[model samples]
Target chain A: MSLDKSVVNVSFLEVKVWRGKDDGELVSYQVPGRENQTVLDVVSEIQRSHEPSLAYRYACRVGVCGSCAMTVNGMPKWTCRTHVKKVMDDGVLTIEPLRNLPRIKDLVCDLSPFIDTWQQAGAPFCGTKTRHEAPANIDPESKARKAADAGLQCINCAVCYSACDVVSWNKDYIGPAGLNRAWTLVNDARHGERQSTFDKAFGSGGCGSCHSQGNCTRHCPIGLSPSESIAGLKKSALFGLPKV
Target chain B: MERSLFLTQRLTAMALGPLVLVHLGLILFAVKGGLTAEEILLRTQGSVGWALFYGAFVVMASIHGPIGLRNVLREWTDLTTGLINFVTAGFGFLLLFVGIRAVLAVTQTATQISG
Candidate 1:
């Protein structure tokens, strides 16, 4: 039997992508939009066909990499998972590099500041696991694991950074994603860096700075709740810990 | 001071949510019945009930607004928090004095308003 041919017609989609370095402008490019076309597909198509000068960054073309996040239609989204039908309006799409970060080139943002904030927020998993590390059994339903699971899905995408009004207002604020990351490490069983992490996470312009506008949670691609993590941090901050 | 003030602000806000609804309902009922400002004033001008209601309102509001303003000053201005707290506390007392004066003008005994 011959293949049951059902060829889906690909159409040229007009995507208005932000171009240039920090001092950039919005430039238009048309790309092939297939049946299940993602935002990254259009960008890559632009690079392949129309504009060789267009610069953007992405490694794995799936949601796993988390490298391809941008502001789509006035909202932050993981471009790899964001389909054309979800964001395209009247055949016009406005794509911008993520906000609250420096733009290195067209559609590609420098994540150094975002990653640095994670470090500053004390998000590293410092192990208390020694050279004589034994197989430590953790109950799946344990309080720490349950708490950590909610926040551990962060792909370090700066979509939360772009969505955070607090970060926009107070540049010193570590923001939702960073704070969420810190929350995960706080629940980590083997992390030796918990106390120091808690200290930095509770300081001025840290968790206290978040007004819980629900932006980070609202715009998150994976249904993660940064707002809840921030609330948890605030509750922890109000404890018997000595204040400076 | 910060913690206590924050707690008071939340408490007052909880109080005001209902008070505001009641105030709005009163206004709406009066407007619906075609009651003039003069007629409303005549009812409230000497009533102890009106005075007590307004007195409680003034106290709660005076407690809340200044604390909220202190945070606003700290966030928006170059003012030191100590300075902000001092200025806001002074303003709260000023609001209390004026509010109390108004309440006394309407709610106190005949001799109190006249004197």
Candidate 2:
């Protein structure tokens, strides 16, 4: 026999993607695939070629926007950042909407709770500067700025919330992304609302409840580690504060 | 209940942090050095320090594992009642017994080791 052998070039996918209106049925999808294809690519292919009825959301194809995050193969992930070969072994893929939220329709989980929880996490940047005044200068190398920068890249994907086991169990718990956001705001030097943000994220179903299981870090497609951020928060709560 | 649990978990974790790391480091060093069991016992025999260290490790582990398992059962499994506590307590006692026996053997002098 010759030492050289030919390789197979085929595009086939068997995706068990959830389908229907709210409170709907699970449906299977079989679509064409290619090497280096993403889960979002598959959904888009299905929408464009096979079934025009599929619904999903995405603003940027890259991981930067965090808009195209979805549950791929049982883990919440940014679909845009995920490759088919990495997740879809055995030619099988199961696509589901993000968990711990209302499902608006097939493949689209409602993001209203995520936003609401962001507020619950106290993530808004509140400064005294008015619209007419010159912008206050913030030092990039400052400790506060670096701490804030640690969590500022989050795109509000809800991937952390969906990937969080704590959020699923304790519904009151503001998930990792929200807590991570709160941490950044807490670290903002311009923000006078630091104490309030701390108060919001420190109690029951809060930063203390995290078991440091690191599921959020494991699943984050953007490489932001919310577990570290949460740990930082816990440290502040426990030891860094001056005695009251 | 919350305060006690948090305190206990923290205390155990604090104790375990160094103990587990030291334990792992010792296992690695011993196995890599190809040290025999007799050589290992030679150092440990009649050593109160080793007994205390191992005793603290076992006690901390007994406190840590059941609390962790308790949370897991509460979250993942539906088993709850006095029975869960009874089982957890029983497990802790078993760990204490086995752990103490190992510590005692290591603490015994050379004559006691062979005896």
Candidate 3:
């Protein structure tokens, strides 16, 4: 789409993009405002036209890939999906790396910690059925299946992880994303290591650490409620375990 | 330990919810409804019902208060889990001892009233 000269001549967005590693300065970029512009478009323009050295991550240029999440005006958002007009505050936008993770570079935080927490939560599914066994037919309408289905679509974007205050306060907290993934696995009847997964979830850095502040649910791009999932985990942990 | 603490915190909170409402409602009634200390104690003194009600409240609060404080201390301070747990357990015991003593004093007032 062509930019309107009238709109470009009138005003430009005062974009403050974070530059360099953690503790780096915010570099300002002046990009002409256009109708129906996305935050990603501004970043791309800054990289393509102005600052080639500016580093950020994105793929598919849509919401599906989950690679383009960043802190937009103090809120963690999927930058590719965030419309510039909608999020503009006082005609300015402050873009930075996701919170609660170590910043790697400009608009890029290292996701290793977030990914490791997922594994720590024991989220990966291990089926009990052997190769010789026929496929276990799961009724989608079943209560357990439905409960699992609510949290199954997580893309591991770490938005919930970034949004979690508990994670921010406690580095060891398994976080919403990890707990949400674990909640899915817990509801799966075919999961081989259910007891172990429960053990991991109830460990020191597990779901017990979450304060149920609901920031993870509020900022989730895909509308998944990790808060609810974590609550479920807490309940399951309470019911599954023998009386203390 | 973490999981058990989490469970106990939640359980205590559930117990505290109704207890708190009753406590607050009693306070409001006492303050606004113009009931004097004697009038209030007349019903409460030697009453097993009041003893049980406040006993449960005290029990739940002792557990809940320390756990909540332990979390806040963990987040805001540099204290380790072991140290915090040790300190908070002492605090819970202190609350329990004092609270039970106060409850016993009020309940034992029946002898004084009769004498």
Candidate 4:
């Protein structure tokens, strides 16, 4: 693909990028804009031409791998998927790291806390079948399986985690992603520790902590509804324990 | 446990939903002709229906209010969980005592006076 020289040099976008950790200041940069340029493209431009020390993380620039999420103009989003024109305010952009997590540097945040919360919610699936055992037949149209399918597409992007207000307000509260994962596992028939998942989900800082604000649902790039999953967990708790 | 508290709050809220509507509707209906304490007591005094309805209302509210407040305190304040639980439990008991007393004053006292 040949680059259009006229289009490349025609427009410059004013981008304000965060420069440090928690106490960071927004450093301004002039990034050359192109047609259909993404927020990741803007950051890459700043890194290549302007600031060599600009720290950010990205891979598979095509919206997979869930690595390019950042807070673009006060909203947590997949920067690779977010168009510059869509979020720019009057030809200016402000980008920062995802919220509710420890900031490592400029646009990178420590996802360890988010992962820890997932474990706390008992999100890891434990199957009863051994390697020699045949696959358990599950009806795809079953209600439980359907419910599990609703939340299975989560790529652990942490976008929903960053967007959750409950996580922001209560640090101990396991955010939407973890609860969503647990919901999927709770409905899985093959899961060996469904009861344990239920225990952790209904434990302190679990599904009960969710405010049902739907920020996770709204801000998810994949359109997954973690709020619904948490609601399912609450409803399941009311009925009885999960089937082991 | 958090699960039990969550269930209690939700169940009480469900009970309160219709109770609140009926209470508000009664208020609106009763005040149409301008109600007084004597007139209110005249209708409610010695009434089993009124006693049961208000008794259930008081019980549900006592359970619901503290759980909701516990959630608020947990989110908004930095208080320890144990302290919050203690305070909210005390609040629940206080609400129960006052609510039951009011129910008795409205129903039992009226029944005694009329009898």
Chain A TM-scores, candidates in order: 0.90, 0.88, 0.93, 0.95
Q: Which 10 successive residues of model 4 chain B have the least lDDT summed?
A: B106-115
Off by over 4 Å in 3: A1-11, A241-244, B25-44, B109-115
Better of 1 and 3 by DockQ: 3
For candidate 4, what TM-score does chain B get against the true chain B? 0.93
- For all the models shown, what interface RMSD does each have? 4.5, 4.0, 1.4, 0.8
Off by over 4 Å in 4: A1-9, A241-244, B109-115
TM-score of predicted chain B, candidate 3: 0.88
lDDT: worst 10-residue window of model 2 chain A: A2-11
Considering every candidate listed, which one attains the maximal lDDT? 4
Q: Pairing residues by index, what is the TM-score of model 1? A: 0.73
Candidate 1 vs candidate 2, TM-score winner: 1
Better of 2 and 4 by TM-score: 4
Candidates in order, TM-scores: namely 0.73, 0.66, 0.88, 0.95
List the DockQ of the predictions in order: 0.11, 0.09, 0.56, 0.82
How far residue B45's Cα lies from its native spot in candidate 2, in Å, is 30
Ranking, TM-score, top scorer first: 4, 3, 1, 2
Give the clash count for each candidate: 0, 0, 0, 0
Which residue pairs show collisions in model 3? none
